[model samples]
Target chain A: MKKLINQPEDAVKEELEGVAAAHGDRLRVHTAPNYIVRADAPVHGKVALVSGGGSGHEPMHGGFVGLGMLDAACPGEVFTSPTPDQVLEAAKAVNGGAGVLLIVKNYSGDVMNFEMAAELAEDEGIEVEQVVIDDDVAVKDSLYTAGRRGVGATVLAEKICGAAAEQRWPLPDVAGLCRKVNANARSMGVALTSCTVPTAGKPTFELADDEIELGIGIHGEPGRERRKLAPAHAIVETLATAVVKDLPFGRGDEVLAFVNGMGGTPLMELYVVYNELHTLLEGWGIAIGRNLIGSYMTSLDMAGCSITLLRLDDELTAFWDAPVNTTGLRWGV
Target chain B: MRDTVTQGGLTAWLRAFAAAVARDREELTDLDAAIGDADHGSNMDRGMQAVVGKLGGLSPDEAGVGVGALLKTVGMTLVSTVGGAAGPLYGSLFLDMGKAAGEDAELTVAQWATAVEAGVRGVQARGKAELGDKTMIDALAPAAEALSAAAACGLSLADALRRTAEAAAQGMKATTPLVARKGRASYLGERSAGHQDPGATSSWLLMQAAAEALASDAPPDRPRT
Candidate 1:
């Protein structure tokens, strides 16, 4: 309720304008059917990578749009999935001669919209392949639920697949790499406070001061369960254990450890949580070959953090180390 | 006993639907908050508002315009404005309905039934959801079936629509005891039960609006509330 914004309705549009202004050198913001595409798009023979979701999770699909990352990102309203038309436009804009790869999260809206876009693109004679990430371990895949929600691993998949596409990998190969990354990665999150959506004008959910919600989705949806607030170490242990156990990440397995802040959490706390995660993984004899620690994925000012672990091999580790230039992530440029 | 639904009646149905969605906006959001993210009400309202605005631009006696064109406009508006699973699902529904209605200025009761059935099938195909999945299809499928059956039984247009709305309401209420098998609420597993599906509830409201707007004595230009 108490946030800096001109109006509730203009929040997404205004923020996009700022993103375009700030990162104009690297990306182009297309309006009408809002989407952000890399400035140097249609990289001549390279396959294009497109991913998108709701608006509140800044630096995700949008911020990641640039070199060695996403080619385009279509953002929807806050906490809402982008429509198929937006996705179709993005695909059309970014598709190179090789094809287009859609790195979609496994949410129902994202899946359906991307599916429709793919169909539309195919109708227009554009080749398209899609990979759905459902790496969150918190939500159990069952008949009652839609399946596991995609979480932090989405960022990892984007980076890895982007690198593959940059190397001129075919659409199917890049998509296959993305699927592998999603399969090997597992993530879990715990929220200390609920976020207030701009239009909703209130907290998404009320949590007692002494409580924390575990296994939360990035949209501020309630987690698997609420429990008494605990120290940072205990929280990290809970999240790490869930992810590791779900993947059955065993001793001596090389992995990429990602400790992501959920927007509102401070770097001080993120590092503290990462420190605990390192210790826990070391205790389990899992070798951390590579690591990323920051607010790569977020839930719009929610105070929480998520832990992700991707079992790594020579190929994935090589792709992870490739040059990348994007607003949200930049290294080896 | 009206036998056919005119373009004017279709326009009125959309207006009534918009008004109903605006009236129940908060309720839909509350229902969504219980299982899915809380945006269904606001998202649908925003889409319908855009649809009504577009409808206002059409000439009063646009004889060339037909039900198909009007419904296609509504579908495009909803797809662009509503930014969720419901957007694409509902958008596909109306788009397929428009296709089924073709260029006819008016549709007989059987033709209306066919269009409604096509819309429901479009949602099913788009969402890949089945009956009892606790989605909008929970209400839409039954209503479409009932409408088709009523039409086959030689019921009047108003009577068939009334039966369709009643079936939708029943299906909406039926969603309470069922667990979700698709969409965001499916993440909640067993917790998704006990709460009525927000999409189904909205579907029911839309059917109710159809029944009201397509009644035999309904005014073509009922003033917006």
Candidate 2:
């Protein structure tokens, strides 16, 4: 029930204020509608990228708003999708003459809001394309649910697609690249503890000390099933197997492996999980062409990790290696 | 009984809906906590509070614009303030309703039915959800249908609205046993079945408020179970 905040309602705004103060050189924070944009936006000839969702997943959509990533991010209340007005305002602000691309996670709220924004932006004569990320393999059936929740691959897609946009890819091309990234990626997570959204003032869900929720989503929603707490190797096997088999990733396949922390999970544990993941992939004869190990996409302060494996082609690999600078991710720049 | 709801009655309906949301916020959140992230109650409460705030500030001249303008204002307020699926869904309901109602300051019962139907259509178009999806549509679609049927039968405004509210209540209860095929609750699979959908429950409250507020002159009905 305890959080370091002036008030529960101000959590998103206050954090955004801090982001503005700390990353002023790289980004600008707009209030009233609450969106973050690149400090030097309207990169006139480049296809601008806008991505957003609920506020709890730190650094994502917002921290990623800088060079070689998202041009803007619309942040909503914690675990709540940003409204269409926020998205529309962001799209309008960041739309370079080329066009704008909205990278949306596959949650219904995120989808509907972004869809509405796209419609609004289109009505205003802006060319807009939206790509939805649904890489989580936890949800079994798209027919029965809203579909798999977007997870770790969102970080990868933003980075790669941003690089593509920087390369002056057209709106459709950038949107296509984003969809390619999502289509080739699969992710799964497991949570050791539940997170407390500030407004709710309680844990989202309870986890017994001896159990873990496997295939968890980023929002602290319960996953596929709860199981007895097992060792790192065993847990990694369940997660990695679900991901690899879902895509039917085969021997000799190359991938960009991402091991992400869910807020409260320390880097130490993520690395441990990554190590096991590496060993498991090696056993399966899949080549790890590149790796990102961090808490890039987190679910507030929940103790868990999600592993995203993105099958890589030469194009994707090149994009991954592109020079990038953002508050959350930086390379070669 | 009046055959139409004036602009004032429409405004009262909104206030009543907002009050109902505030009263049931915790219960809605509890329902969501069982199957989805537990924010439905608070999110709706925040949106409705914003709605009431906007309603309170409307100048007398502005308030005379009509039911359509008032509903659009409410919809925009909800879309901006409510951050979840309900924001767009409920906002669409009101927005499309407003669009259908046009600039009319008063609407006959048949006109109200048509507007409600349009609003439900908007919800479907926005969410891409269908009936039996264990969504707000479960309650709202049936209510819209009942309203249309009552209107076709030449029922009084109060009688039609009462039937609409009853249909919505029945649909809301029906959601308890259905497996969710939409929204966050869908993630739970079979586990989502036993709980009543927070969205449908809220929609039921909305219809209930409409019956009460828009038909204030009618005799009181039996207490709800």
Kindly report, for each predicted structure in the order presented, the TM-score of its chain A compared with the true chain A: 0.99, 0.99
What DockQ, on C-alphas, does every prediction get? Answer: 0.69, 0.78
Residue runs of model 1 more than 4 Å from their true location after superposition = B58-65, B215-225
CAPRI class of candidate 2: medium
Native contact recovery (fnat) for each candidate is 0.78, 0.89
Q: lDDT of candidate 1 vs native?
A: 0.89
User: Which segments of model 2 are wrong by more than 4 Å?
Assistant: B59-62, B216-225
Candidate 1 lDDT over A1-333, as tens digits, reads 789999998999999899888888999999889999999887889999999998888779898998999999999888888988899899889988889998888889988888888888899999999999999888876456777888899999999999998999988888889989998999999999999899888998888999999998898766779999999999889999999999889999999999999999999999999899999999999999999999989999899999999999999999999999999899999
Error of 1 at A333 (Å): 1.2
Best by DockQ: 2
Instruction: Report the Cα lDDT for candidate 2.
Output: 0.91
lDDT of 2 by residue, A45-123 (tens): 9999999999999878798988899999999989899999999999999998999999999999999999989999999
How high is each candidate's TM-score? 0.95, 0.97
